[model samples]
Target: MKKHIIGTLLLGGWSLMMLTLLQSCDKQEVFSYESEHALFFERWKQVSLSERYRLDTVNYSFSHYVGVEDIEHQFKINLIGNLLEEDAEYKVIVVDSLTTATEDQYTIKNPVFRKGRSSDSLTVVVHKTPVLKDKSVHLTLRLVENENFGLGYMGYTDVRIRFNDMPTQPTWWTKEVELAFLGPYSYEKLETIVAANEGFTTFEGLSLTEKRKIALNTKEYISEHGITEKNGDPMEIPVY
Candidate 1:
């Protein structure tokens, strides 16, 4: 009777082990998942950046965050410079000491988005040059698709940025300061003001809403009396 009972218990144990193995195999096959590939910058980053950084700014960095969440994955983020089309007034720099960065200058520190982390970053460094002071220059960078990952978002894939050591008036600077009692001034004029009295060199730090408030007042003033000088004389605004 004892031998028969022991045999029954052994058989039950074998069946339980087999079931566990089968379930493990099924779980391995059925519970698989694939995470999509996406590499992007945060939405707040300007799509096209144009600003005057302080002359003291040695290096300017542009970054894009990897959208992939895989821990064991390695990626290559290559920067390809898409130049400005041939125009007499414009300059083309395929590779230069002034534009293309050296190993010491620009580096991809950690392109790998390790396991368990959702994001990684790639940074491009722009070295300041005397040429940037004389004229504003821009370079366009496109994120090419690789075997590991494709370009993530349409809006963020291409980055076009112009940086200058000197304050080149921005395209947004439409109206005169005297008429608006507000913004929109050339770098040279700012320098003049600094030399003569007190002034802010750039409005880059100002919030967009704050900038808009000044613009609104300018518009209201113009609508009421057309743009007038401090002396109450009619002033001309350049369209170009």
Candidate 2:
């Protein structure tokens, strides 16, 4: 009876081990030939909006890379907004210029092992009904990895727009200030300005004379604009 019980336990353990190994092998096989690819898109800021009284035409330039070939991939675009609300109304038009190309010199329309490529350019127009007040709307584009036969990968981007007569201004003050202050300062110059600012200095002990000198210099610089000249230019002084 004891022998029989030992035999059964051994068999069960062996079966469990085999099953675990098989599962791991299957996962490895699935991802064995995986290739790295990425897709990205952004709205054109300069030409993104049209005149308030007219139809607004915009273009979104998309970029992507496929490391391998011979796989069929599908991309989908979705829009979400309150445009259909009782007080809001708008219409959208999308145009696709289907152009395909490979990153390599191999001009094969259809690739097998690691060949195949394509590019797309889309032109979109958003028309606001005269009755609708100007308002902001959000648009989202999603690229699903529909097929994964060890070929290219996938990614996506979502964009937001305001459909009103006036453009929406960004509410983040720090970003605006940073941009204004650093507009003329190179990274290196900004570093130097920060280092020269006494407020940024930390010492274990500051002598009375040293503190007086610092205070005098700060006052003189603020009153006579000496700091701006010493720093090379007002543009070189970082606001932060």
Candidate 3:
């Protein structure tokens, strides 16, 4: 990743000055400004595009990560600049195309954004039921036209997400590992390991370092037992 421009700007990026400035400015400069966030009708929030997600098998909970930037605070750099308070709501519409109906309404864990804070976000949690195991789910959440935030980045006002818990090989899982030990990508192998080993839980539960440890540990497993897969076809983790 590139380092942002040193100092001065809160973040290294260009801002458009289409609207008139709220305060006095130099000949060609806008001294202060604020963006209003708005979500158009049926606009899907740009979350993740068909990304793989993991479930906490121990608790049956799912978490979708999203971020909110302090665009207003970043503009308040001048001596007379001011930042306005903003709010974000967890407005979601379930796609009726799924085989099962999603009724979990505990969307936003903390929906309020108090003043003075640079930025904040809703936890945006999803609770899974036993019925979801066999159904495909699609969720679109938009930060609609709320009085709190009126302006936002285009194509980012809302996020459309499809949820899945299958433990497929992630990007970090290398082809080298696949050739040497694990077959291809096996959800069944992942399930077997987690069910047998108390230490091996959800893939998300492990830290980056811990996940790395599992990679080498898996190599050891393959060396001792020969290459293996719980399910036929496609590579996967070796289960005990």
Best by TM-score: 3
Scored by Cα lDDT, where does model 1 land?
0.39
* TM-score: the better of candidates 1 and 3: 3
Candidate 1 lDDT over residue span 65-136, tens digit each:
112111121122222222213211111122342343333322223344333334434444444554544554
Write the residue-wise lDDT of candidate 2 on 24-43 in tens digits.
66534222223233222322
Score residue 131 of candidate 3 by CA lDDT.
45
Residue pairs clashing, model 2: 100-118, 134-164
Ranking by TM-score: 3, 1, 2
Segments of candidate 3 deviating more than 4 angstroms: 1-81, 84-101, 165-171, 180-183, 195-212, 215-240
What is the C-alpha lDDT profile of model 3 across 1-240, one tens digit per residue? 133444335332222232234222322232122434332222222348875332211112122111111101010111111343533352434334531325562243444544444444434455444444455455554444345444343333344445443233455335644554344555544534443344554445556566556655664554565545554443344332
Q: Model-by-model lDDT, in order?
A: 0.39, 0.31, 0.39
Task: TM-score each candidate.
Answer: 0.33, 0.21, 0.46
Off-target runs (Cα >4 Å) in candidate 2 are: 1-38, 42-118, 148-156, 167-240
